[model samples]
Target: MQVDSKAIDKFLVELLTEVGTRLREDSIKKMSVATKKNRNDLVTNFDKKTEQFINGEIKQAYPDATIVSEEGYGDLVKDMSGLVFFVDPIDGTMNFVKRGDNFASMIAAYIDGEPLNGAIIDVMDNEIYHGGKEIGLFINDRKIDNPKNLPLVEGLVDVSAPMALANKFAVQDVIKKSSGFRVYGSAGIIFGHLLTGKEVMYMSYLAPWDLAAGRVMCEAAGMSVVSIDDAPINMLESQVVIVGTQKVVSEALKTLKTR
Candidate 1:
């Protein structure tokens, strides 16, 4: 059965718009914060509440669809066989808890293990980057052109802070090949820059929700989405996600191997 792309996109836009507005409004007040894996890795009340709200909405709309969310509200999805919605209600929870900016809400829908549609809402900027297999990438209802295929040496690359700090996967070498490096602390926002051509490439160790939605948008915009080792991404697990033009990906991989 072919899913209705237009209908899915419309529903997602409405859902994400509401999520973004609520998150922005909530940021002004004090939030309850707690740690998950470690002290530096934090989660706020809004993250749990937002994920619950989104999960409820997804269930109401499509009960059969399985949700794999960052928060504990989703199911333990073993595979991406049927309808699966990956949700990152707050991609940058630390940023939301501290800076209250540079965070984003991302959701991607996959059917039969294939990306069907994806949406990333830049809450601070009131901009939405969304697209699917049927409809191309769009920002706030306007169709945007594909980003230029700039080389690694010509443009800035966004790297995860931890990756750069630890020199993981010889990312520092790849950074030197670029004009410079940027650490946004949020995969969704970094992906936004990659889609708009503000950053030529982005590489990080990311979870499924972190890269799921952005993967759809990046591929739709004529960009490359692959592992740092030059392999296809596994949508159900964490991996080193690298997104950029072909030239940049090739160059970055070569640099990592040589290092």
Candidate 2:
């Protein structure tokens, strides 16, 4: 089937903006919450509610598109085939629940397993980082260029707490080679930073929804999104991933390759 990049980009931006507004409204209210894997891994009424909304809208707008989403509202996708959409109603659920900020809503579209476009709405920041291979990159309404292909020593790296603390993937070695270390606990927001050149690198374990929008946006902006283990990028599974400028990725991959 023929895919329309312009149509998809327009739909993604419009839908995410509508969803972001709802997320902002929900942020201030008291919502029921429950634990998943651990106490810190949470699911809220808003999370499921928002995901259902997005999935429903996607189905209505593009009936043939299969959705992969957090909160169990999506299809049971077995492979990255056909027209697919990935949705994270709240990318930083912990941040959204505990702090009422720092979270985001994300969606990305892929056609026959190739990225088409992605959009992330930082609910608090009110900025939507969007676009992909076909549309270029945009933050809300403004078009932007790629970040500098900076070396690892010149910029700070965002490391997940568990990865940094446990020295997972020998990430400490990667951090040491960089200018410094930081962690924001949110992949979408961190990816936004990477797109704008606020940071040079981000390393962490991310599920499909968490990785989808960021991966599309960052890669489209000329940044590198890769798996250090050299596995093919799979959209249906969780894995350790890295996103950064091309040069920084080369530098980081050298250290990660040792693991």
Candidate 3:
């Protein structure tokens, strides 16, 4: 189905808003938290419930679409063919478990690897960034303009804390070239900032669920989202990616030390 139209946008916004409501209410309740991948990688009861909720909703609405999701409640699809959905129930789980804030819920649809529409909810703020290359982007209902093509020196960059500290990919070099550096711990929030010109560039290792919705919104806003190693982005794999203005992306690619 064509998802960039007003009707489709409304459907998506309502869906995301419902998810946001659940999150807002769950934030106050005591959550069951657990570790995933490592001690620091946390997942909570709300995360699983939210993912199950989203997956069920998607199945009911678009039964044929294959879902790739952060939580395990999705299909184990190996390819991005036909209609596909990528979902991150809670984009910043650590922050959600710790601060009860600075997190988001993201969902995006793609048709044979090309973005159809993406929806990202800044849950606490009640703002949803939703749209695509054809329809542009909307913060709730406000249509936003493209960001400036800022030079690396004129803007601040957001990098993962570990990458910055370890100087992985020569990230610290790129950080020193920019106005400064930041770490938001959530790709969805960082992508929102990029669209609003709050930050210039964001670099992090991201899974498909983490990158999908943000990629759609960023590209719609005329910002560049590219792989740090100068490879074509594969939606089925995890990789270090960069999203920013064209100028900043170019500088970051040049500064990136890849063997």
Candidate 4:
């Protein structure tokens, strides 16, 4: 069967919108939360429900497609060789549970290890960052202009709080080269900033669901998305993500430690 990427994108847009609305309503009704594997790793009822909703929709849209999601509502797929919807029902679960902001619902569609489409819903603010191979990116229905091809010293960089401070992977060197660094817990939000060119680069210890959507979108926009080692990220695993303009990426990679 021919993959209808457009139809899938449309379905995901509507689905994420509905999920965001429901999450907001749930938040207003009551304050409910749960802890995941650790205290920092939080999960709300809304998270599970939203994942369920999105998972069911994706199954309906492409029954053969495998889903690897943040919540328990997906499979333990070992590869991305076929159609797959990598989902993060709540990208910033800690924020959602504590601050009630900075959270997002993210989805990435990949076929045969190639990214087809991606959508990240800024649930708190109701903005959708959407993109695909054929259609470019949009911030809530408005097409975003292309970001500048900035070098390392000329632009903002998005980094995780831990990665930034631990000076892990010689990240301190990147900070010294860049104008500054900003840490947003949610990968989806960082992705939004990257696509808009508000920052020169974004890096983190990203999981499959965390990196999937942003990887494809940034690549489609003539930007770069790769691991700290300047290698393509594996969709089935977690790794260090580095995204930026071509030049900035080149500079940052030079500072990164390859394992």
C-alpha displacement of 113 in model 3, angstroms?
0.6
| Candidate 3 runs further than 4 Å off | 1-6, 31-43
- Report the number of clashing residue pairs per model: 0, 0, 0, 0
Winner on lDDT (2 vs 4): 2
lDDT of each: 0.87, 0.86, 0.87, 0.82
Model 1 per-residue lDDT tens digits across residues 1-259:
4688778888899999999899888776434434434323434567888999999999999899999999889999998888999999999878877787999999999998898899999999988999876898898889988889999999999988888888888889899989998888999998889888999999888999999999988888888898866667899889988899888988887888523
State the lDDT at 140 in candidate 3.
Answer: 92
User: Relative to the unseen true structure, what is the C-alpha lDDT of residue 42 in candidate 2, on a scale of 0 to 100?
Assistant: 34
Q: Per-residue lDDT for 1-259 in model 4, tens only? A: 3677777778778888888898777655445434444433334566777889889988987888999998789988987777988999888777776777888889989988888899998888999888787777778778887788988989989888888888888888888889987877888888888888888898888899998888878888888887876666788888988888999988988888766
Q: For model 2, state the Cα shift of residue 143 in Å.
A: 0.4
In model 1, pairs of residues that clash are: none
- Residue 255 in model 3: lDDT: 84
Error of 3 at 19 (Å): 0.7
The stretch of ten residues in a row with the least summed lDDT in candidate 4 is: 33-42
Candidate 2 local Cα displacement, residue 248, angstroms: 1.0
